[model samples]
Target: MNPYVIVSILVAYFGVLMVIAYFTSRNADTQTFFTANKKSPWYLVAFGMIGTSLSGVTFISVPGNVGNTQFAYFQFVLGNLVGYLVIATVLMPLYYRLNLVSIYTYLEQRFGFWSYKTGSFFFLLSRTIGAAFRLFLVAAVLQIGVFQQWGIPFSVNVLITIFLIWIYTFQGGIKTIVWTDTFQTFFLVSAVAISVYLISKELGLSLGQMVATVRESEYGQIFHWDPKSSKYFWKQFIAGAFIAIAMTGLDQDLMQKNLTCKNLQDAQKNMLSFCTVFVVVNLLFLTLGALLYLFAESRGIAIPGRTDYLYPTLALKSFGLLAAVFFLLGITASSYASADSALAALTTAFCIDFLNFDKRTEEDRKKIKFRVHVGFSVLLYLIILIFEALNDESVVTAVFTAAGYTYGPLLGLFAFGMLTRLPVRDRFVPLICVISPILCYIINKNSEAWLNGYRFGFEILILNGFLTFLGLLLLSKKRVAEPEVIPGE
Candidate 1:
């Protein structure tokens, strides 16, 4: 609970990451930064991805979300399982065969320049906002938990957090991130486990008893069949599958790490392993959420207005110093693990997709990349500030809604490229991508009146993609001969 102790822990944490970056980055070049020279171990990449996929949002929100949604989120988790399988069997092979550094390059080769840029821009827009929102959550937590007591401004906390990420990632990029994420995943999971154990102890329950309690609690209810509810099983499951494909298979931040594996087979293995572990980790978070509510009920404590605040408030005020220690460590690990990787992916995308980093001399390339990297860092800093000034919704909700809009176009573009052989009117590809999200926004806003009271959820991504797919079809021409099919079917 002491501010000095929290600062000390943070300093020590960044020191370890910096040391890791120093050694990994020795003699690193652009290839090493972007692809880790394609030598990352499958096992490490798999483990590390657990951190990147979850982030601070999942660390806090999923469990916190249990109070309102109950176990309904489990439906989405099941959907993610199917989505991962699709990525492993389909997308990974295509990416490896193409030998892509930035996955959007597939668009340029398959469609044309405009489609390629459109895809890359969607990624840039989606990831920039997603990563900034995540960093914002961490910065806000640190500002309240540690800095306010020391009379530091929120802006300073945001700057320091982003600066730490940049310091370690600026050198080795994916090479450093692949390893650091693995280390952070350990602390993040450990924090949840410890919090679970301490809460059980406070309630005087053994591990078995704790499990029993959570299983029987009202918050543990998982299945939902109501058509009107957003968390209904089929809706969540189907949406989760498409979300995984769109966000992970199609996302540069995640795929960048996947591409670092030695080969296609290794990448598939990593994805499968990551999928299995991801399910287990989420179960732990849900159980912790149920137990938190139970603990509060037994002690007669009032639940916070925002469920996101539940974990932090209890850890700092209700649990003792030890719980606070792990809470800080866990949140920092989760937030930085995702944010740092995203920063690297954003830099790689801009340099390759826009600036053509490969065309320049080695000396010139490095200078351009360094400046671009700094530029993205500044962009992320500004976005987080904007979010702080205006955000009123739960961050988890905001992130998925934003993804539905930004990542939707990417989902449509990739789906059209892979699933069809027709070539679109090249110049119109960007317009189609742009219009798809706007149409989606309008439809979503008026769903109740326009669609007979049908409320859209994350599945809005699927609808957006379909609209884009239809738009592409209108602009497309069938190949003269048998069309070239995507490699992995």
Candidate 2:
């Protein structure tokens, strides 16, 4: 519970990451940073991705969310299972065939210059906001757990947080992230597993009794059948599939890891392996959530007003020093695991997608990559400050909500390119992508009133993508009979 201990744990943890970065990055060049020289182990990528995918949001929010939503989030996880299958079978193959450094280049091949840029732009936007939201949760926790004791400002906390990520990632990039995330994921998963055991011990429940207690408790419910509620099973399941496709399959931060694999088959294997683990890990989070709520009720501890605070509050103030240490480690590992990857992917995307790094000389590429990495680091820092000013909702909910709008166009763009043979008005692609999310925002805001009390949940992403798809359709034309040769094919 001591603030000094929390700081020491954090310092020591980063020290380890610095060591890893140094070794992994020793002979690193742009190729090593961008694609890990296309030699990352499938199993390592699969395992490390657990930390990247879950991040701090799941570490804190999902379990805390159990008090309110119970196990309904699992429905979404099931949907994610289906979505991951789609990614493995469908999306990954296309990315592999294209030999894409940035997946957005597929858009350029399929559609045109504008469409490619549009897809990459949305990725940049979606990832920036999403990463900031994740880091904000961890930063808020650090402030309360360590900085607040020392009277440090939140702005200083944000800078320090982003700087740690940049320092480790600036050289090794995805190569460093692949290994560091694996290490962090071990701690992340262990933290939850150990916390669950400690809570069971505190509650005097055996393993069987713990399962039975969670199963029988009010928080155990996982399905909602109501057609209008956001948690409706079908809605969440379907949304989960598309969310996986859009956020992971379509995302650069995640796909960059996948692309680092030696071949398409390895990437597919990685995805399938990751999917099974992803589902099980989420269920574990849901179980931990139920246990947390149960522990709170039994101990007469008041849940915090912000559910995001519940886990940190108990671990720091109630559970002994051991829980506090793992909680800090788990959160830090999970958060930076995701954040560091995002920083690398952001740099990679900008350098490759926007800056034409491939066309540049080696020395020029090095300087540009360094500056862009630093630029995005500063950008993330600024956005976290903005989130602290404006955000009032659970971070998980906010992330999904934002993804619904931002990633929707990516879903739409990819679907249009793959599902249809029609040639689009390439110049008009940006306009359609822009209009889709704005329309989604309007529809979501008035859905309950306009649709007879129908609340939009994660399914809003599906609707957003559909609207974008439709918009693209309107702008499409019958394909010319001439066989078109894609550049570099």
Candidate 3:
């Protein structure tokens, strides 16, 4: 709990990452930065993705959220399982067949210039915000755990956070992330597993007793059937599927790692393996949540109003030195694992999709990539400061809510291109994408009042995508004679 100790842990953690970056990034060029030269081991990618997918939001918020939402989030997790299947079976094949460096290039090949740009633009928006939200969690915790004790302002804390990420990632990029993430995932998983054990030990409960206590507790319920409620089982399940598809399958940040695998089969194996581990890890977090609450109640600790604060407060103040240390390491690992990849993906997308990296000389490409990477890092720092100023609700909720609006167009664009042979008026694509989310916002705000008290949750993403799809359909003409085909396919 000492500020000096926290600083020591952080310095040591980043030191490990920098060492990994050094070895993995040596002799690294553009291909290595963008695709790890397509040589990453599938198993390592699968294992590392667990940390990237969960991030700090899951590390803290999911457990704390168990008090209010119970196991209801499991419905969303079930949907995520389905979504990952779609990504593996449907999207990954398409990406591999086309041999894309940036998946958004599919939009260009399938549609036109505007559609490709539109898709990439949405990705930039969605990932920038999503990554910022993830980093904000770690920044806030660092502020409370270390900087606040030193009277350091939150803005300065955020600057320090972003700088650390930029330093390790700027050179090796995705090549560095694949290795570092695997190392960090170990700490992240261990922290949660050990924290749960410590809590049970403190309460004088055996493993079986701990399981029984969580099951019988009021926070253990996992399904809601009310159609009008946001947490309805079907709504959450269906929304979870689409959220995974849109956020992971369509977004470059996640899919970039998948692309780094050698071939389609290897990528598929990575996804399926990641899906199985993803579910088990989430269940562990939920279990930890229930235990945190029970531990608090028995000890007469007042629960924090913002559930996000609950995990950090208890870990630092009451859970002993060991728990606090792992808590800090777990959050740092989860946050950086996701953020570093996001930075690489953003740079990759801009270079390939926007700047025509393929057409440029290698030397010119490197220079541009460096500037773009730095630009995004600074952009993320600003966004986190802004989020710190405005965020009021749970971060996990805010992340998905923002994704619902931002990623909706990507879902629609990909869905429209794959499912139909018709071409759209090229220039109008961006307009359709823009108009879709605005209409979705209006519909969501009035859903309960106008739609017979039907409240919207993550399903808003589905609606947003559908609206964009319909808007594109309205602008389409007669179908072409034949669909375009790749040479090998």
State every prediction's TM-score relative to the real structure: 0.98, 0.98, 0.98
Worst 10 residues of 3 by lDDT: 480-489
lDDT of 2 by residue, 50-117 (tens): 99999999999999998888999999999999999989988888888878899999888788899999
Estimate the TM-score for candidate 2.
0.98
1-489 per-residue lDDT for model 3 (tens digits): 998999999999999999999999899899999999999999999999999999999998999899889999999999999999999999999899988889998888878899999999999999999999999999999999999999999999999999999999988889899999999999999999999999999999999999999999998899999888888999999999999999999989999999999999999999999999999999999999999999999999999999999999999889899999999999999999999999999999998988878899989988998999999999999999899889899999999999999999999999998888888888999999999999999999998899999989999999999999999999987877136533224
Number of the candidate with higher lDDT, 1 or 2: 2
Highest lDDT: give the candidate number.
Answer: 3
The TM-score between candidate 1 and the true structure equals 0.98
What is each predicted model's overall lDDT from 0 to 1?
0.90, 0.92, 0.93
Residue-pair clash count for candidate 3: 0
Give per-residue CA lDDT, model 1, range 125-191, as digits (tens): 9999999988987887798789899899988889999999998999899999999999999999999
In angstroms, give how far residue 78 of model 2 lies from its true place.
0.1
